[model samples]
Target: MKPAIALPLLGLAPLLGASDLLVKALGIALVALPLLSLFGLLLPVLRRALSGHALWFGALLLAGVLVGLAQLLMQAFAFELHRALGPFLALLALPCLLLVAIEPAGPGAGLRQGLLFAACALLLGALRELLGHASLLAHGEWLGLGALHWQAAADGLPLFASAPGGLILLGLLLALVRLKP
Candidate 1:
């Protein structure tokens, strides 16, 4: 599958997790981008050590290890952020594995995909926080930072904070991106 299409699909879990809070989204992006790029850079070295099914399994193992390490670091430095991520943190490995299995493997491809994912996560997170709660970075304290709440004049649409609503928004956003000129 094309990275453009595959990434958004595989990233649905993280997107939902991120959509609830901007700080969580930032954390997800910060952790994901580097880990993915590192995975891409190390792909060739792993390929040289294993082949066929072993390569696939080994790649997944490496991705899992990276994800685990990231989780540990998040837990250490940002415990609340790590707790907020929950299962979505583990699910991150799925996208990494997919990226590795896809064509045009390299640091550049990983970086491109990472940027795309980060943009989507941040946009969705900010929009949801704004629309659902009438605020932004309401949980900034999770990262030991002061909350950067932006209160709106009126009430927010509540739906944007939920999974179904996020899915709807994601569909609309993806549709907009895929539109022809």
Candidate 2:
């Protein structure tokens, strides 16, 4: 039998564990599951809107605005990593624009465009996290964040948080985005 089925038969809590891994898995399931579902529902509509190259361009511009707003909010909160958000947002833009750029002006293009932005965004986020962690290891601190010791063991590595499992969620989002139409 599958683990999900066997776990209950064994009288074990499916969520058993005190490790950060359990917490992170729970966090991703809680947050990303809904987001993925919503994206799936919204994909068709977004593809329709992105039918035209002009519309695609406009959407990219809007994504830029949204990313900017996200950064602005991060800054307003006095977040230590405010500067990093801009680069991450920019990284998101790549896949968003790629869908439009690669799109051929014809039928079914709408179906192809929906999750491109989200995939690009996730990939960029993962890359950012990895690069950030590497930088932290090299310098013993996150670059541009001064000497704020972002303890890797307890908190997380620089590229992404550990418990929350942001990278896994990111990977899932990318897979969802790349789904065959």
Candidate 3:
């Protein structure tokens, strides 16, 4: 399954405890809806005879890096929604990177895959923000991360809280390193 389709479901874990029954149902729908939409968007492309799995993998890894960076920004800005949803979404990047690193094939395909993944990430991020805001308004707090709205916890560590992104970046770098002749 596409990261777009999978990340939001994974992201729901953080939000589960904080949400009420109705809010939880809404949240689940909100997350699942976007994945469904992304699936619709991607299905046509997937139906095509595209065989460059490696490039697609690299694209996904790149998209993960971008998603991580966005989450880092959210953390920096103390966006509670991001703190809740960011890491889980970030996790999707790994399998894609591994896929690319192990069996990447073409050159341009990675770029295409990256663009597709980026589109999905952007869509999911926006949805999360909107749904989170709504959930907070209705329930008096965001879904998962609670009312503790503070800047990212600081111990001056690299990739401190956003470790998933950091790991994905490391994976991407390693892939590149291995790809080098």
Candidate 4:
């Protein structure tokens, strides 16, 4: 629920909305999805280290630090992506903080939530980038794999880049997911 609102809001970069397929392919999709998963992995540690309300407050701070570290790592290793993603990376800690504040520590709950989060982020990112930009996979050189570059022309609807458009797209997607087999 949090991510359904959060993912499209944060993923509005030109890199994501590139008109080229290769650029979209090598964009932040790799880094962005796993960061949430890593936060999930860290949640238990944060919970164990800080009991009571301290865990709630401390987890937010810790998640910010973790996201910052990830930003630094991306800057050091993948400078182009770090530059491309820019301030958007700061948004990654949001779900982590929310998760820590709201969810109880249950067996495999974090895992389930993390996987769902990753899947949703990936799907939302793809939809927002593809439909909004009129491109599928774009920019492989950012990942240092130039050989994988590819792009097809797309006229593209302009609205998917906008929040209202994303909300509509998300609504339709949610409806599709809820349909019974």
The candidate scoring highest on TM-score is: 1
What lDDT would each prediction earn against the true structure? 0.80, 0.37, 0.39, 0.60
What's each prediction's TM-score? Answer: 0.90, 0.34, 0.29, 0.70
| Two-way lDDT contest, 2 vs 3, winner | 3
Q: Model 4 compared with the native: what TM-score?
A: 0.70
Candidate 3: what lDDT? 0.39
Model 2 ranges off by over 4 Å: 1-43, 84-86, 98-181
Clashes of 2: 2
lDDT per residue for candidate 4 within 63-160, as digits (tens), equals 77877887888888888867756665676666566566555655455455545555554676567667766655444466766675434486567687
* Residue ranges of candidate 1 with Cα displaced over 4 Å: 1-8
Over 1-181, each residue of candidate 2 has an lDDT whose tens digit, in order, gives: 1224332222111111101232212222222223333333433456677666666666567556544554565466534434323243333333334434433444333333333332333344434434334323222222233463332443335424332454445456547866999
For model 3, residues 3-95, the per-residue Cα lDDT tens digits are: 354442343232222222233333333343333334334433433534467546545645455556545654665455544453454443443
Colliding pairs, model 4: 21-137, 21-138, 22-137, 22-138, 22-139, 23-138, 23-139, 24-138, 25-138
Cα-based RMSD of the predictions, in order? Answer: 2.1, 14.6, 14.5, 4.8
Error of 4 at 102 (Å): 4.1
lDDT score, candidate 4: 0.60
Largest lDDT belongs to which candidate? 1
